[model samples]
Target: MSGSEALDQGPLRVLSFGCRLNTSESVAMRDLARRGGHAEALLVNTCAVTAEAERQARKAIRRAARDNPGTPILVTGCAAQLRPAEWAALPGVSRVIGNADKLTPEAWNAAAPPAPVSDVMAARQAAAHLVTEFAGRARAFLQVQQGCDHRCTFCVIPFGRGPSRSVPLGAVVEQARAAVAAGYREVVLTGVDIASFGPDLPGRPSLGQAVRRLLALVPELPRLRLSSLDPAAIDEELWRLLAEEPRLMPHLHLSLQHGDDLMLKRMKRRHSRAGALAAAARARTLRPGIALGADLIAGFPTETEAHFAAMLDFVTEAGLHFLHVFPYSERPGTPAARMPQLPVPLRRERAARLRAAGTAAAEHFYQTRLEQARQGQKETVLMEAPDRGHTEHFAPLRLVRGEARHGAVLQARVLGADARGLLAEVA
Candidate 1:
């Protein structure tokens, strides 16, 4: 049969991009597509976080079409939702499904779906799509919430994701249990605004409460981690988890967009420079050796050198070991886009400088850990590969072959360091 004919009766092959939340949703799309009898179609689950992400998606669509020949291609996710007509006009695309409609089973069927997705801003809740396994990985992502309530001027996700909504607490626990039963050693609770979890649910349980309940109910879950955290939203329950929960991994990736007060205000962020430092210090105090990571944007509208300098200083002051840096990209319709803009080249240059700082901080943190290793400290490592695993502090370690089996949680003694990761021997 022709590839298109086969697609009419077969399962879907999903190409996922972007955040862990997108990864989680892709699994559901595949399952729904299979049940809907379009198992043979190819779905491009796109990301629109940056212009580059969108560019890659468009490139991949053409590549999928070229490689698959007669196979039908379908597009969805944030990118498609944000620019439905743009995706629909692409050469190989047979249908362009919106973020909200993609989860419904009927939308996955071979029949052409409805045009231009309903206004995503009108969306009240994120659809609940349960996934049993993570397809190919040892770790799985469980989505507890969807969308964002915050409207940071530089961000486009809130519009793409809609107003904040959360999955019920009981539903979250059930999903965690399923993941454990499926043999996943680690499960990450992911969302566009994970910190805002429970506000829409009854009693408005905080993210901390959700984590506490999940860990308590799923005792067998080996490791639980969070995808991203907003600095202003760190609650007491989360602090308690850091202090007492051994199963909770000791890594936090913070959403601290800018370090300068004026830039922060312009970005519409809730936390201040001092507040971020305090939160990081508190986390470390509660869990000694915890590694802190952060997301930083290098250039924004009206950003001066002094503003950039404050951000550069904030990295070291806050002692951030890992950083995700982004050069501000102007998305259409955002307030920041209309502000006095920075030179595109300058934005990229600043981003590069921030990344360099991040590298130095990472190297310094690694050296400090190695010092502890020399002093005979050991870390609990979760083996992702036969020769490598990540420590509880989220540092990668290379193991001596045959020293520890894959998937084994071993007390690995760090012997020394290399450019990529720490070299270790099973203790």
Candidate 2:
């Protein structure tokens, strides 16, 4: 083929998988590819948050190889971090770069070791790990930090991601500008620990400082969102900025792994249920009615019935918008993994109860919003369901008829709570 023919081939499609933290690294990878004069490489960013996610990621790899034959594949992110060896053995994978290489300055060099492909079928079936980045979404995330220092016994992330490290602030600001110019309405500031955004950096300008710098870079961008944050990471300045910034999403996702103090201590997590409660209260005081969500591990080792009740009470009183609940899964390496295991039956019971609590909390928060909507509170819902787009808040406002456009902020009048969100008809 001629040089012109190769040049017109296409941009490299790179995909990353996992939470927002991985998204930042993947964005860095895309930048590296673009600057090196190979802007045509279409980077396919993929995700693998669960076993299903892993399976789907592998599926994407195979699909990519088939659709674009001879493409040099780069497998990366948490899946890479956790199972680099497994990916290295897969067919169609030109490079099996893991957590280490994904973040390296040269993410898409395509000049690395090739896989052996000894057992092509085995490699193909192996799962894709969690990737931090998301591609083709309206928003992009800048992962400022990686690795969770928290030793939550139910979590395998600390093991998979290793020690926490912050990306240089200057680089982050530059990345944010590029993303904004690319037409992403929003950029999610993400990381394994976003609150620890600049702790490893000299002077640690703080997560708030980093975000303020980002806004300063692309003030025109309509919105920016911060991913999960530990209550311990919150400070007065952070909430104050959130209260003042219109571009920043009024969404604070606090990680409340468990509501019981003793269970939290046993998990080696930093915050107590009381501490989490205080943090939520602080956030509400600053941004009243701001959407606050959280995560909860339903059952930890040594969690008694009383402990579960305490967790339920805490969540109920705290008024969380929603929660992502999980039955504690003991990974191969972790302190809780060695403790006297809870029977599968009990784990199921505890998880179900916590789920109920989560639903009640979500409903209560939703109802509060509904009441406000009834009283003529203006809700700028991203009209999606009845043929349009939706909100980053992720609340479903049942399919309603109107001129609902993707990205169009609708002035909705709340009818009542329907199957969707605060059931509102477009006004």
Candidate 3:
């Protein structure tokens, strides 16, 4: 059958919700369905990071059913893990699978599922599996691990996703090669804890080794990036690999929930603000001019004035380029939700303060870049202008008064900042 005819035979309309890891899994699953010639109607890959996440997942499934009224619904992901009963009972949901075995076809067809999906794992929590062998896309991700071993008091992930898991390095490399061959320009190594990849295997190759092996396998790819990693997961070797690999994107999105030590402890996080700073420092030293992004939870239970002040101070001093601020939300079955809850008024106040701070912090970062460019520091930019590219710094420069080839990094002379990006002249 022709490829188009094959797709028509059994079309699985895939949808996804949740974190990057889940999104990656959905893409992998969709590819499998397409290749296998079996289609699903609105195969909803739902997410449930927070309670709102669960609500949204339901909304997504219902919307899918509304859009494709006659299609079947497949519900899965974190939302499925912690709330299988709710999902399975949805109007059009045909099957609901938890993190345990949702990625595989057989596991997806399991007759029975857990209600809350609290406590259970299909394979060894660390069993290395790659489900995207025949997947095609402009870019693809390899889910190297699943579940979190860390039972942070504020998190329901442990109860839902089980323990830390890792995929085998060989399977990961092979899948990456296949994806690259399928015309994917980039391959992102992703997971619930990709930093924990290779642990399921006896050899326990470091995250760096797994990435380097994949790069070696697909040396022709234009880009290779990583999903977020726990700040505590890196080491000297990882830093070294990052420094040397030009193909690796110059971005390190660290998980820094709060800047105060007390708040971090309250959240049951493994790393301290100091620890996060130290890692950022090391990464900066290894790769100068790298963009460092971070996650910040503005308000948490029991956070005090002193704690918030400390956090604000740390953020200003950290020289972080960008921040993703989230106000604390209580998720069911997590310890933090039941802890002495912060007043809604207080949470709103802190969120406002943090939002203002984020603006100032970002402005300072942008102004700093302007100053550096003024100092005659020219950087190579990669042109992303479909017809153009920008520098390594990602300063969007116009093709401007000259013919520039697509995807070539050329020295750009910064004109000045505008509502657009770094307006520049091709040097």
Candidate 4:
């Protein structure tokens, strides 16, 4: 699980869980709650990606009630959206807000009644919320799309997020502009299925088109990044952007659930094993030395030992530098949940193996980076903290000398390498 955090310095505290999109929404919700006079409330933005995620949210809710006494706890997010009554019955939860109304002004009004959960599947249009601040974050997560249209057999997110929707290009530019104006050196475009962006809008512009326009319109923005992308859905324009746009960071994280062809088909993933490999190859050809990452599920229903072995080898074959490995967690109401199940211990064991492979891959990639650094190659580092930041390829870097300020972008030369990241000095 991605770490959860309390946003803002106001009386209204927000605990955001799960994805960057939730974090972005939490920032907006904090402002809305303050403006609507809900200062004494604690908002819990929950995630339903895994059963463990939901368990953590419930644990947090109980802890918040025990520690804070009478502070009203408001629960919302994919978890709460999927199971409103379950969350509402928890101690100290005064309201259970759904995803559809969580950002609306009325939902946070102190005088407003508890709003009924709207049908997320009926959400036709996604409106852009101009979020200029990210509290403690150096990079801003600018949401350019929302919801999902695909129904992967093992996933339940589409039900919670609804149909695919795109925030208009003009509004996206405005938000990017606002984020850049607010001192963010990097802006990550986030959404549920961002590659599916723009088909719902006028002229049906692709994600590539929107990104190209965003870069063109905001020349002041130093670096732009993207959240997880669908390998099957990447368009020609986006491939060209990777080849040509220097401002676009050279890191691509693909939503590749599994590497085995049969496993991918069972997971209802659109891209096959060969197709995924081709995508990785294309990315490398377009952007030399590009770092590739993927979301891989370790164990799925009916996954044989051979299938697991193939997936483990695929990581090395694809040259994946980063991996988000999830042990198969059965979300009820999903197709995979009904299939023959694997033992929990076995699933976890496979996850560990996948992670081990990923670590080895990362170490190899870092060694190459270190070699480049030793050769006096320079890298642009975005300082997320005083002593640490990340390179353009999204590798963690540490400043061994030369003072660095948070949110400052500087060119640096690598001095050394370690297990965690690179050691560098401002150049």
Output the number of the lDDT-best candidate. Answer: 4
Instruction: Evaluate candidate 2 by giving its C-alpha RMSD to the native, one decimal.
Output: 7.9
Ten contiguous residues with the weakest lDDT in model 1: 1-10
What are the root-mean-square deviations of the candidates from the true structure over C-alphas? 4.2, 7.9, 5.7, 1.2
Ranking by lDDT: 4, 1, 3, 2
lDDT of 3: 0.67
| C-alpha-based local distance difference test score of model 2 | 0.64
- The TM-score of candidate 3 is 0.81
Worst 10 residues of 2 by lDDT: 1-10
What is candidate 3's lDDT per residue for 1-427, written digit by digit as tens? 0001011224676656556666567765565445444455555666655555667767767776777777777666666777678788888776666676655555543233423443445446544444332222234666777777786666676656777767777777777777667655566777776676666677878888877777887788777777778888875567888899988887777777888988888788889888988888888887887777677876688888899898888877676766666677787878888888888778778878887787666555556566887898775665444334544533345645454554345677665654345556676
Best by TM-score: 4
lDDT score at residue 59, model 4, on the 0-100 scale = 91
For each candidate, the alpha-carbon lDDT, in order, equals 0.82, 0.64, 0.67, 0.89
Model 2 alpha-carbon drift over 4 Å, by segment: 1-74, 86-95, 103-112, 115-136, 382-394
Candidate 1 regions exceeding 4 Å error are 1-12, 111-116, 127-135, 403-405
Model 1, total clashes: 5
Clashes found in each candidate (C-alpha, N, C closer than 3 A): 5, 36, 19, 0
